[model samples]
Target chain A: MHLSTSIWVWIAAFFTLAIFSFLYKDNPFYRFAESVFVGSSAAFAFLNLWFFDVKPKLWDPIAKGNILYVIIPLILSILMLTRFIPKIKWLSRWAIAFTVGMGAGLGITGMIQGYLVPQLKGTFLPLWVPGNLATTVNNWLLVFGTIFTITYFYFSKPIKGKFGVAAKIGIIFIMVAFGASFGYTIMARVSLLIGRVYFLLHTWLGMV
Target chain B: MKREIPLLITFIAGFLIVVALFIPHPPFNKIEETFNSWYIIVAGFTFILGIDSLILHNWEKIRRRSEGWPFALTVILSFFITLIWGIVSGVRTGHIFSTNSTFRNYFYLYIYVPLQATMFAILSFFIASAAYRAFRARTLNATLLLLTASIVMLGRVPLGNVALIPVISIAVLMLLWVLVDELKYVTSPTQRLIYIGIAVVAVVAAFPITKFLYHNLSPVTDWIMNVPQMAAKRGLFIGLALGGIAVSLRIILGIEQSYMS
Candidate 1:
């Protein structure tokens, strides 16, 4: 039982245990740890934003007398704070309008280029390869799977007979895919568990 | 006038961004980049709103001596401690009132990281407990899902694959046999023909040599992932893209003003 002599390790271990104590039941220790976590993270984000973004990009440039480009965004940012004032809250809508407009615009182009075009291009697989039977079969399955899955989500008309069968096949494919995703998710969570355990054993107790 | 102006702004911004994608002209190309820079500036300033909300909520709790008011106090203390430490110590080094690294590293590493990690790690236990209850095979679809999930989970870990290898080999052999046998019983001529072709292919692939090839659970899981999972994901991506474009259009056309409210 070679426990860590370092106070930092002890502190980390205590907090880790405090959080894990929620499994037994939520307690003051857990609440204290959770509060500290939330506060510190919020503070960290604030500091990082100020230092990395506002300081370098907005503040320094304006301070250096490069005010022409920075002025519009500065005004927009101050306008955003008008949300706090009840009478002037409507003024903040302009800032929201600008940001949301820009976001929507960028999002549309991004979705087309990044997702729509690429995914459409991906569906164009050659079903009949000369020698590669496995590859050929896989491609055929993929094409049918994609078509049927998309058809399942089609809501304009009633699905019956062939379309119904196709949708059923699509459901099967979706279920299997969901199952695979669930398994992977479980693995991810378990990996986090392994990490915490490793920290406790190796870092705190020297028990690796 | 207020509503119309914002809608017009949305239209102009969205249209220009979309148009900028095709235009190679320097000014048009810079529009998106300029918008992005403004977004960052606006987003950076909005952090104050979030901090103010947190402070107000916690302060009210503290003032009322509400349930878990001590926790609220801890939150406020930790926030200021971290804020002051980061500001005074230059975020990376120089301590103001104290010279030791205690104020800086202790709060971040000891409290924050451990708390975050342990919080996430606790989910593993909950998921495991949930899985135990959820993985029952009461129907054909449920059984298929369970089987696939079992294969994937087992395939991901070393021990599970070792246990699954022989089981998978047997299952594949059984599937091939079932495909062949089912070919004889179908009524429709077209279905029979398709079944025959599949059976023939399965027979050829079901050779003893193929047993050596699929001696692990990985190939089965990989096949399921590559064929079914990839197809479903692509379908979803396409659907999401279409939906996103529609929403963008709605916002741009002033049909969606819910965001402003």
Candidate 2:
């Protein structure tokens, strides 16, 4: 029956309950909690970026008189700040350009290697195995299912007759997959609820 | 000049990175890491833009004395309190504000984490209500979706599996029968050819495929996930990859000017 004595724990419990109150209806408590959450989160992110990344990586070296390499990045960063100035907002585009270009480049390559290659490889399975009959059947199903599903998405040719049947099978697979995802999502949300409930009961009310 | 320069930058950057993937040389291999470092610094500066917007918005609300202006005040105060505490305290162990400063930690632990988690947790109620409305069986597709969702939900939980296994097994068997029956009445020659190919392969395998079907909730769920779910996901992944490459090409070629705007 021992309750949480820490004042921080009490504050946390209050905020948790304040947020949960939204389920009933929005109120001042919920709004206040929401504001505090947004403000603190932004502040936290800002501080972390400043302390961990900008300070150590950019600022410290320059401050310590190692100024040669960091100059370009420093200039780029200042250009990014020009977005606030309406007159020179166009200058900010250079910074945006660099970021977006790099992002597009990196993303394209990474997706090819990480996602496309692996998924394509996954589709390539041995249909018939000597001993493992179940696995073999599952592999066959996987191959056919992949082909049919891909055909469902093919927009070049009109789907009719046999293609229609395959597409129908594809839709069924997609729906069932979506249902599985939804079920998993529900599980995640319920876990969070259980955590909050545990906090209320064990931490706030001292009833385990 | 404004547009062309950015487009050129995009082309050069994208091309270099793409080339870097194949080339294992010093400067080429290091291009991503170098660009990432630069990007981080630039990204850090952009947060200032965000903070500026937040401040301006809240200040405007306060000036106008809008509805719930006090809440706006709360936002501003919390922002400054958190920002000042972090800046004053310093990140590392010891500084002007002592190493054991609980102020920043208190706000982060008590306010931030709980609010975030509770916000997400609140979605559960909404989802349940939404599911209640959306799960109505109006058509064959809707009925199938509802049935699939019900089975998945029931099978996911520990205790539900014991009660729901037989139901899920029956459902799976029914679904398999439907699939088989659907395959039987294909009128299209191409479809018949594909079916015949599969049948030929199955006959050559000479294995009792039905033995693979498990009469349990977990196994049924596994079957759904491994077979249909994975295939659908792979289809999506391939489609997305193609779409992404196209978009990236457009960006590199200066056709996608939306980002510049």
Candidate 3:
């Protein structure tokens, strides 16, 4: 008989069982599978970088006589590789410096506009309109929530009195949001479990 | 000096990029882009480090004659084999590599695809075990947990009520209440005042609070992601990014040489 789709699926079902065997206890099978995964990923990542990202972005350009463009990067790349050398590990410092410098620069720039300012702007929507009752309530609640949450994180200052109480309530709102998120994640994971079980029963055992 | 210089560059470059965003100039944007390309180039070298570490780690284990020596040997073997295959498949030189080779396809299909699927499949039993523990009806909180779990569980299946009746009813009731009271009020006259204020501020800042702002999803789904849900996510990402920067800086500057040792 020709190997049909179902037969291919059966092959997958066998491997799935092999991997899932770890849940019972670690064994040679699990180790074998885990080794396969780690080995494959390492190989994949290394090859993908050279073939997809590096060769085009650097090596190809250099080969085409964009030699000047290649100089700084080639120097940096060599410095980075110096970490592998025993006596000259310190030479890698210059390369590391450039990378860390650039990353921090990018992050700080992105955070203010992408995160901080927008979030702060989002908090103070105009609740003073002519026709919106729920909008008014939501605006007020959000405003209160923002003020309180800000204070909750700002530990440098002491909280006291009425505002302090509002901040405390704000903390509760944050916690409830976190709990809800946790519940949502659990649901997602459990759904995946159900999917696997369904596959095992219907496809492997042909019990469905 | 090495550590200090890098930290200084980081501080300056970070400040410059932030300033560049507000500058509305082309050159600053170009510089930022250039810096970004360099960052990508630097990131490529990290793979070399990974391969080196993998080789050294497995080599040490094998030299020590560890229990999993054969496994380590297999990994080293695969590493070199792929390295060789990828080098040979360098036909498209100026772009991301593609292979028309049957060997590459077979490797991906037989090796990579199953490993990924199997990895996902393994989570099933772990989830079942976790659910069995987490869904216990010991207290009020546990009851709520059980309720939500059952509802979500039943919602997926054909006979949902049979699988998760109690939770589904609670979920339906909660959804109905929100739709009727909160949603209705949100559209009413008093809430109109709030929307005008939000609109004006959002427009002025050039950041509209349009329903489904970032993630192109259904309105209901978008609302869930944008509102309170985004807070923890933003915080988590910031924390992770900052931590990575700090660790990386220390390593690069040679202040944190633990990895090397």
Candidate 4:
């Protein structure tokens, strides 16, 4: 294995090991690395906010002799920071209201169009398929599972009677789903662990 | 005036988007894109508020020398250093992400990526520890969850047969242990015999079950995922959509005034 001679690679290796130290216990090295990560991420966000959004949308238009077009948003942006001043903090609400409105609008439309429509359509599978026993079974399971799961989540009445049975089955489906997700997450983490280990042995130590 | 004006803005904004969806003409068609641009630009400024909060909180900790103040100082230093580096790099190279920039290569690629990745990667051990604690096989529900998770995990990996054997052995052992544990609750000789008989059967069937699973684990896992798992997930997605729409409708109609606060 060829070791990386780059200083940046060394720095990366150090941080990787530092983070891994947490597996032993919470130590100063881990704490330092965690703090650094938090700080770097914050800095990264600040940089990105400037370069991607503020600069391009607000600054560029003004820079290119179109200040009037973006003036409202610029003013709104400034108004957002008025929260630092307690008396004028109410001014920030206008900016927030706009975002909230957009979010609500997106949520409504996104739900109806993106999820509800497609999911309902997919659940409308043919209950029977000639000589395709596996698919037929799966289709029934899918249709019933969706029904049960939805019923489990939605109810104003007490969870009893015939609905209770369906809801119980829904909870089982939910449990199975959660279990599958947990396993999948563990699999991902294991993959990442392998990657880090490979880096440590191959890149850092040249002992693959 | 403060609350009412904000509510009006929210209603108008939401109304504009909904209107744009139905009427796709000149001003109406372009409204969504224009509004999104304005939102993003304004939203960018909100990051400053967040950064200010983080810095102030950390600064307070540092000033008080509260617990891990040195680490707080480290956070502050790292933040400024990275921020200044990016800004200076952007000034010099016309972009912070330009090729050959230290901010891109040194800080971002090396420092940020590794830190984030390793932090997440360490969750492997934690997840394992958590699974061990939670998955006691004490109840049927817990057993079902544990078995589903184990199979899914095992099927995803190679040389799984080599590892599957030990896992199956552990499962067999656990089965026997549970049976023995049940003996404690036996009210009569019949109950004891029933537990013993089950234990014997489990021991006898362990080999065939293990062999079957070793051969068909992947397909079984696929079936579990494609059928029951997919069905459940689909249900969840539908539920989430309906819930989101309800909440959004509430917010848009001014019934939910939490955002105003």
Candidate 5:
């Protein structure tokens, strides 16, 4: 049987086995692998930001003829690094505030444009479909399911009678949704586990 | 100025972008574009703060000779080593992720991806434990969940529909058993009749349903996903978006000052 001779493949196998070893118990190998994962991930993120975000957005304009335009952001970015200095740490707040504001701004606009509007548009379906029983049923379910789900979250007043019934229906829909989500999440993790196992077998050990 | 400046900055940045949405005029659109770019730059710099914290935390642990300090050292060493190699290689190749770069080919592909995927893969075991906690499988909700989750996981396997029969049986039986047990609390004859009626209906309906599912399990899964899941997801998304917009407005209005601290 052909075995993987590559050192990198061996390294990957070791790390994979090392991580899997945690399933039995946390030991030195597992600890080392875990730490390396953290450290290397951080480094990778650092390199990515520098190359993709910082270099192009911050450094390039300054190096080019657009220094006048980039001066503000440059100053703000430098200010962000001032958190290391205790005396002038407050100055970093300016930069932090900018990011927070931008996030808040994007949150509002994005929610409206990306999520809320589209969802509402999707939900506003005609309950009746001409000569299509399944479509008609699905439209009714969508309309009622959405309305009921929203009613479940409505906490301004005490729910009772018909309203309570609608809220109960909402809870059923929510639980079903959560159940499906849980199943899907577990399946996704299972797929990842399968991929690792496949790599260990076919790539590393040449065992199908 | 410490508090006021941040609050003011958050307000101005948030407010202007929202205004730019409604009025995409020359200055407004330009301001939105500039602010967006600046946001990306500033956010990128925030990673430095994250790395700084990680390094300092591990460094302090190492200095103190804390338990697992060697692992911390491993962290620091790997971080710096990877960082240095990446930067040097980036300088050499004009990019850190160049096709020929060892950082990408060996370290990233071999080391980082394997570690990352393994780490996530390890969670499947934890998720199994979690499923034990989650799916007690007595109530209709739990039974439905168990059935759907099993369907999803096994839907792609050969004879997948064959595998699903037992699961559906178990789930249906558990649900029926739960209803049967609830009869003790139901002193009313009509309520007891309702329970028995449901069980009988379930027992009778199981035949055709199982027949359909024995061949159409994948289609059933697709229907569950497309119809109920999407409907619920849409509802949740709408609610979340509305809530997010409210909070965002509060931040822009400077009422949400928690970020300032």
Candidate 6:
């Protein structure tokens, strides 16, 4: 008979307990769970690659008689294997260079499209609204905050007069945002920990 | 011949693929997709390399009878066992770890969900600890932080306001006070000047800014995030991408001996 779904559930709960035990104290259970995680993840990654990528994308295509199909990948893959070779180890540079070059080119293009044009455009928001002090005040604050913060990042010249003051205020806003991000990140990580605990308690020990 | 030709091919092929984006051809797209698939295969191999390094590092520690030897052994053993199990299952026709096998059920139930949840769960205690420190309210900034944090925390839970209106109102008042008249007292004159100048400069620099129509609590906050914030993020992102490229190039080219070493 196929492994029942319940077995999987039970196994999960056990690992959860294993992880949660860490909060109490770093112990054997946590170590066991962490180890299993690494091993399983590695094994799964390899299997999935063999199943999905190397098999269909490379191996299958090559076998189908596209003699030219195998050349580059085969060479690259073999070159990659050269790490095992003691003397001719430098051959792996080609693969690295190719990957890096492409990645850099993609990043350069993305940076322009993603950041520069959009930010400069935001500074021009309409601040004056008829009989809407709250909206007007909010817009003014945003405009002020964005400018100063950007200025704070730019250290080309000494900030003087009004610009310096605004930049300080802008720093506060940025800090607040960063704090929120940190809080949220902590929440996410903690939640994961709790999940492991809950799994251990409910599934492994059967104690709610 | 093998080495020089490959390097030349690397430079030429890399440039061509990048320039290929400007070309509106189906083959260009296909080549991009092929590269993506290759990335997955390479990533898998990288994972193996990582595990190997981990094992090697841990093995040395264990052999020397250092601290945490048990943990190291546990890691190495688990890795080998899992590999053996998966391989055995994959080789067997109807085995559970076979392709699209039921092992995924085990992975999902026993591993992924629990790990994810546990990671999130650990935050509760940390939040409580942070709240203790940040909510002390010794200073005006501290007070503001406490108020916003309390509001947000309460907002996260259902019936927060209904159950704790007094607390919520107190926090809201603190926020309002800071935002209004209190801001002048707290913000230094130099800072104020910077704020005004920035406001003026931002207005002047508005052209060529990306406009995003998205929902948010504050329009001003959204605008800042979408525009200048996005720009800053993009700059960092570009740097990160370039770094990734450099690292990848180092590895693929075998110029980087750290991994192999």
The lDDT per prediction is 0.81, 0.77, 0.61, 0.86, 0.86, 0.57
Candidate 6 is graded, for docking, as acceptable
DockQ of 1: 0.60
Model 3 lDDT tens row, B104-193: 555555455566766775665666677677655554444444443343333334544343334334544554454345544586676766
Candidate 1 clash pair list: none
Instruction: Write the residue-wise lDDT of candidate 5 on B171-260 in tens digits.
Output: 578769888889888999999999999999988888788888888878877887888777777778788888888898998888888865
TM-score of each: 0.86, 0.85, 0.71, 0.91, 0.94, 0.69
lDDT string for model 6 (B134-248, tens) is 5466665554444444434444455544434455345445545544554466468776666556555544543222122112223433444444334334333434554665664
What docking grade does candidate 1 earn? medium
Candidate 5 per-residue lDDT, tens place, A1-208, comes to 5799999999999999999999999899999999999998888888988899878886787788788888888899889889888799889989999998999998888888777777788888988889999999988888888888888885666789998998888877777788778778887888999999999999999888
DockQ values of all predictions: 0.60, 0.57, 0.30, 0.73, 0.77, 0.26
Tens digit of per-residue lDDT, candidate 4, span B35-69: 88888787676666667789999999999999999
TM-score of chain A of 5: 0.94
- Per-residue CA lDDT of model 6 for A90-134, tens digit only, reads 776556545544554454444444444454465566799789986
Error of 3 at B97 (Å): 6.2
Per-residue lDDT of model 4, residues A1-208, tens digit only: 6778988899999999999998888899999999999988889887988888877887888999999999889888888889788899999999989888988887777777777888799889999999999889888899999899888887766789999999989888888888898789888888888888888898788896
State, as a TM-score between 0 and 1, how close model 5 is to the true structure: 0.94
Q: How much DockQ does model 6 earn?
A: 0.26
lDDT tens digits by residue: candidate 1, A93-183: 7888888888888899899888888878888999899999988999988998888888887545577888788888888888888888888
Q: Which residue runs of candidate 2 sit more than 4 Å off their true CA positions?
A: B91-104, B165-215
